[model samples]
Target: MCRLFALTSKDPVSPMEAIKALDVMKEGHDGSGVGLLLRDLGGPFEEMKDAPILSGIFSEEGIRKLDLFMMDQGFMTKYKMSIKVPKQTLEGTPKRGLYLLRAYEYPDSWNVDTLDEKELATRLMMTRLKIREMGEEKKDMIVFSFWPDTIMLKELGDPMQIARHLGLDRKDLKARTIMAQGRQNTNYAINLYACHPFFIKGYSTMTNGENTAFIPIRDFLSSRDFPGYMGYQSDSEVFAHILHYTMSGLDLGLDAYKHVITPLQDRDIENHPDATFLKHLKKSCRQLIIDGPNCVIGTLPDNTLFMAQDRKKLRPGVVGGRPGMFAFSSEVCGLDAVIPDRDKSKDIQPMHLDTAIVGPDRQEVKICRQTEPLTLPL
Candidate 1:
């Protein structure tokens, strides 16, 4: 398993000192990086990286002779787990702040994307604009958070053919994740959360005959979901359609031509009503949980929830997905946990909220709130 550690200090410290205090030894050979905080006195944070080799400290012992660190994946992960660091080294230097940590598989694998104080502010600017767009809708809007793998399946041509290419038995594979080398490995990696607006367009266009659209909530209101034979091709589209139907109570199709598998129900039923459309939707959503689709992204007003791994249950009040405050996690559960708490805290909340409200009407909005700048730890 790979091990990672993050550190923050009250004062600025040398990159070398930070690593040593962490008790990260030279032999670990894990790639390392140092990040500096950037702000709009100018630009975004820029990343600096170095290849890992044997630590120079180890060269004197003749185990390896190199000033640079080697990015030996195995060696780095195994030993770094137990490395220790002293807290005293964090005393007064310049400005104190938070940082990131990671274990790189290769020196070349190191990647950095930083948000400057101004950049973060700018992001909030864009988010507010989005929220405004959402608010402008005459009808309630729902977005289908498409799972990337499902889109990949549609992209790879017919599902059965993809299964065959992956050497997966029709009986075992669900026509997804092209099984590589006879159902042993997975080749078609799908990053569901990474789904961009372009991908949404691709998936939306796959319907058999009806003109499907990748309508941004800004432009179109979705029609209700219908059965496959009735013309609904994908659940994501259906999800949006149903939400619009629920919010508007206007049928997009005529009764003579339409058939309802699940009848549309009223959203404001005071007492629990059986056999309503809302009830049907709830039942289906619960069933979907048991069906094993990775719940990486969730659709909610003004935000979306994305997890790196499956999340069995969701805590209420957790919301995220502003442009700058992207969710980052090794697994879905990790991100779910991180998002809610981070979003609630004083530090992240203002920025997230500020972004959502600034939509199209405003050209620029200045942020009076300031967060202590952060750096990425080695």
Candidate 2:
């Protein structure tokens, strides 16, 4: 199993904190790869929240093509943070040329005053796909996300070692919310794209169990005709897309997400307050239901962090911390490494019917159980 660690705090913290937490749970995961998704960013990115940031790796020729393409697309480079890769990288780390986090201004042709959020998101996703396709042949570019206040860094090797290789230990690189994974490489080959903490638009998620229902779920999502749902390099990628679809596509609430992905059985649904609605959801979303052993941890567009388990509840995960800060990990030791001062009695270990959520305010965690009333706004 891969080790999943996510933290959301009122103040920005370095990604090294999460990396160190993953190091504590190093025994659970093989040193195959590491993926980090930082959102609600800090440092220089904190001042440029409006600008969409592109995070990925690029070769020498790829950077040239990216610059020209951005120019043609009318996006101006507002700010760029390029990692200075050391001459000698840790063994097993891929030989990457350029690691970049570039924030771009709105296109010259667009009316910034009238542009809506959805339109902006669509344009950014399309541009990212175009760049991805351009580099497919030579493998010059490997773009993870193109969204505001978000930056993703991924590489192959031990999590802590890769962190140093990418200069993630620096003070300037920080975010209020971070989702990280230490991959085990049990199912898929050791490919960078197959790394965890997948992102689409503004939603991001990472999982810690084999997705037995990946193919059908992928097929259902692909049929939706969404460009951002195209990459299925890893089975866990579907978790992020499923989130985008349920909340953004269907206009559903967070509680509805657990219902759609892992709906209650008929016996349980019959006792639900919204049984009629739940029945319809189960029937309509049958293809999306996940059969697992999986534990999913994710962050919404608003920076709300959540963790949910499959029916089997085979994967281990826990959330613990005080108000203004919280950490979710696959093991208690991981949380102890980050926020040891917190009360252990309050730590949450969500079961098959629970979804532990911490809103963007960094307030207390609210556990929403499947048996409870679905009171969240729809």
Highest-scoring model, TM-score: 2
**Candidate 2, superposed: residue stretches over 4 Å from native:** 375-377
Model 2 lDDT per residue over 1-378, tens place: 999999999999999999999999999999889999999999999999988999999999999999999998899999999997889968988788899899999886888669897887898889899988998999998898898999999999999998877779888899999999999877777788899899888888999998989999999999998888987888999999999998889888888889988999999999999998889889988999998889999999999999999999999999999999999999999999999999999998999999999999998999999988775455
In angstroms, the error of model 1 at 300 is 7.7
Going through the candidates in the order shown, the clash numbers are 20, 0
* Candidate 1 local distance difference test against the native: 0.21
TM-score of each: 0.20, 0.98
Number of backbone clashes in candidate 2: 0
lDDT of 2 at 31: 85
Please write out the lDDT profile of model 1 over residues 1-378, one tens digit for every residue.
111111122222222221232123212212221111111100011121121111000112112211122223122321111112223332211111111122122322322134353343333223223322342332121122111112121111222232233232222112101100001002213221111111121111110111112233212232222111111222223333333233223322211001121222234322333334335444433322211121111121212221111122221111232333332221233234323444423222222111111111122212221121111111
The parts of candidate 1 lying over 4 Å away from their true place are 1-198, 202-275, 280-290, 298-378
Model 2 residue 10 lDDT score? 96
